[model samples]
Target chain A: LAKTTQPISMDSYEGQEVNITCSHNNIATNDYITWYQQFPSQGPRFIIQGYKTKVTNEVASLFIPADRKSSTLSLPRVSLSDTAVYYCLVGAGRGSNDYKLSFGAGTTVTVRA
Target chain B: EAGVAQSPRYKIIEKRQSVAFWCNPISGHATLYWYQQILGQGPKLLIQFQNNGVVDDSQLPKDRFSAERLKGVDSTLKIQPAKLEDSAVYLCASSEPQGGGGNTIYFGEGSWLTVV
Candidate 1:
């Protein structure tokens, strides 16, 4: 499993864009980068995933460079409800027999009104 | 489209006592996972099951913890002689294994355990 490093917490204002970067220098070749959003007393929800380059969904976008050593989760037009802990996970393959996705401390995003 | 369901949203017990948690995955989900989440940290995988069979139990403490998935549907996890360190949330997640393909995982609200 690749260990990820992210900021403990970050603050942003409503309607502004927020980018959370994760460093996984030891990420495996087959590993895929995934981001999840978790609110208090709830489970983590998938936001976006990427192997390389950029992948975007209705909720968020993931940008990974050629090296695949790092990835960034970009949330556009954040709202107060966006306040949650964002996790960056690297897995060999999700939902597979070899899957046992590990998580780090995660980045806590505080969206101010 | 019902998500994963876990029973007993919260539990309180004394050290060395026993406790059990139940989970029902989404319809037709073949893969199930159990995780332990401690305060101020992320979830750690404890076990993974596929269709009533154990796929992985490398991290599970077999000495005191056990889990079973019967008929490839609902499952239960039991911890006998629990310790204070076991005071954490137990989460259940499920997914349809797609032959190493990427699929979003759905998780239950989790069973919070407080072992004093």
Candidate 2:
């Protein structure tokens, strides 16, 4: 399992773009980068995932460099409802059980008016 | 489709008391997992079950915590002689384990346990 490092907390206002980056210096070739969003009292929601390059979804975009050592999660035009903790996970592609996720202290994003 | 289900959204018990939590995975799902989330921390996998068999349980506190998935459907996690450190949200999740597709896990509204 690869360990990830991210910011502990961040503050942003509505309508602004937010980018949270994760560092997994020892990421493996089979490792895929995924981001999850969790709100108070709710289960973590999958936001975006990518193996390399850039993958964009309706909710967020994931950018991974060629080395696959780091990835960034970009949320556009955020709203107050987006206030939550964000976790970055590096694991094997799909259901590869060799890489179990160990979530670190996630980065809590506070979206204010 | 129905999502994963968990019972007893909240539980409060005194130290050394026993408590149990239940989970029902989505229909047709073959893999189930239990996680413990302490306040201000991300969820940690306590155990993973592929159907009725245990896949991984390295993080589970076997001394006081026990879990079973009878018939590979609904499962129960029991904690005997609970301690203050055991106060956390117990989450249940399920996923497909048959093959290639990225099996995004679905989680239930976790059961919160508070040991006084």
Say which candidate scores most in DockQ: 1
Q: Comparing only chain A of model 2 with the true chain A, what is the TM-score?
A: 0.95
Q: Highest lDDT: give the candidate number.
A: 1
**Residue pairs whose backbone atoms clash in candidate 2:** none
Q: Give me the overall lDDT of model 1.
A: 0.91
- lDDT at position B81, candidate 1: 96
Q: What share of the true interface contacts does each candidate keep?
A: 0.68, 0.49
The TM-score leader among the candidates is 2
Off by over 4 Å in 2: A97-99, B97-101
Q: What level of docking quality does candidate 2 show? A: medium
